[model samples]
Target: MKVLLASPRGFCAGVNMAIDSLEIALKAFGPPLYVYHEIVHNKYVVTHFREKGVEFVDHLEEVPHGATLLFSAHGVSPEVREAARERNLTAIDATCPLVTKVHLEAIKYARQGYTIFLIGHEGHDEVVGTMGEAPEAIVLVETPEDVAGLTVADETKLAYLTQTTLSVDDANRIISRLKERFPQIASPPKDDICYATQNRQEAVALLCSEANLVLVLGSQNSSNSQRLAELARERGVAAHLIDGAGDIEAQWLDGVETVLVTAGASAPEVVVEECLDFLRDHYGAEVEVRTTREEHVSFPLPKELRAVSVE
Candidate 1:
């Protein structure tokens, strides 16, 4: 068997920044640090943090009063911020700058009397966060068909913003449908899908062209990871989303001569290496590294933690 590895796979700039922020917080404040959600959508990453005394919570109410809180890279709604303030928690905004950009756009459109159509899955953390920015004015749409059924208060005054982690092709198709229905609608000045998401999806597409099976390393809840697997399937290639090497089944390798290995934006490269090691030890797979794009993007640490000491 042969293993083809996708380039630009694993942790993106935003995930790196978020994780570093948490680690810094843990060092500075010590145990019982509260995170609004998983620092990133990768199970392995979350588990590692949990073992290091980080506490992940879905609601702010779970956090004790006046404790330090860190928002996830997926970002949070204004309501979450208000809740943090009400609880008197020392909050740090670890939200990805790209996700923050979408929220600002939603707020801008809402303030101008436009009904915003948010294109993303219903319950994704990023979508939930963006929608929370202007829930009264934003409607969620998952598919092109959903766009057709949209009943807006004013068609002439409509705008759309998308979740940062979405399938580029799918978002475009849905955007096209919205354009057909409401030609006057406005959209973000540029595509909202993050650079890392776009790069990884494009890399998967490249892998699909030559491999029989594509394995995406990420948690199931990871939107970008799920999109990578779905993109391979859409291209008629078999794909699986696994948390790590343990999730790989021997049956999956049967009669499979070539496999494409890739990871989501939040996944660590170490996990991908473990998967690669498994394929090499069991299947005697010959590995080849493939590069579709070169990424040099980097985001600075959160402001509040800049001066925080880290051991």
Candidate 2:
């Protein structure tokens, strides 16, 4: 068996910074650390943190007053931050800078009296948080069809922003539709989809040409990971999004000579290694790496964790 591993596949700069922030917080704040959402939407990363005493809560009421709460990389709305403050919780922001960029854009457009159309999956943590930024000013559009049915008080004053982890092709399709319906639709100065997402998708698409099946290493809920699998299937290749090596079924390997492996932006590299190990041990797979491009972006730790010395 042959395995093609994708470079620049897992743990983008934002995920690394978020994970490192939590690690520093865990050391500085001691036990019982509380996180607003799954740190990065990866099952392995969240489960690992949970084992290390990080409490993942969906609601602020579940967190104790005066506790230290870390926001997930998905980024929280101003409302969530205010609730954390109301409870006297020491909140540390771990939201990805890219996601934060979209939030800022939403705030910008809303402040200017423009109706913002957010291109993202409905109910996604990032989308939910972003919409909360300007609830009354922003409208969620999941598909181009949603764009067709859009009702706006002012089409002349319209703008669009997208979730950071959205599929590039999907976002572009939606953006194109938005443009067709409303040529005056304004866009963010830069693309909203994070660089890591585009890179991983492009890398996987390249690998798909040589593989009989593609294995995406990420949790079921991971948006970018799902895109990796979706990208492959769109190209008529078999693909699966598995949380880790254990989730891989033997039937998936049947009649498969080559497997392309890639991880989502939030996925941990250790899980990718584990999946590789599984394929190597079971099928004696030979590995080859496909590099799309090198990424050097990094974000500074939250102010609260900057002074903490983590071993």
**Residue 243's lDDT in candidate 2:** 87
lDDT of 1: 0.93
In candidate 2, list every pair of residues with a backbone clash. none
Instruction: Please give the lDDT score for candidate 2.
Output: 0.91
lDDT (tens digit, per residue) of candidate 2 on 1-311: 99989887999989999999999999888879999978988888888988999999999999999999999999999999999999999999988889999999999999999999999998899999999999999999998778878989888999999988888888889999999999999999998899999999999877799999999998889999999999999999999999889999999999899999999998888999999999999999999998888988888998788878433
Instruction: Estimate, for each residue in 48-136, the C-alpha lDDT of model 1 and write its tens digit.
Output: 99999999999888999999999999999989999999999999999999999999999999999999999999988999999998889
Best candidate (score: lDDT):
1
Worst 10 residues of 2 by lDDT: 302-311
Residue 288, model 2: lDDT of 94
Residue pairs that clash (backbone atoms under 3 angstroms), model 1: none
TM-scores for every predicted model: 0.98, 0.98
Quote model 1's TM-score: 0.98
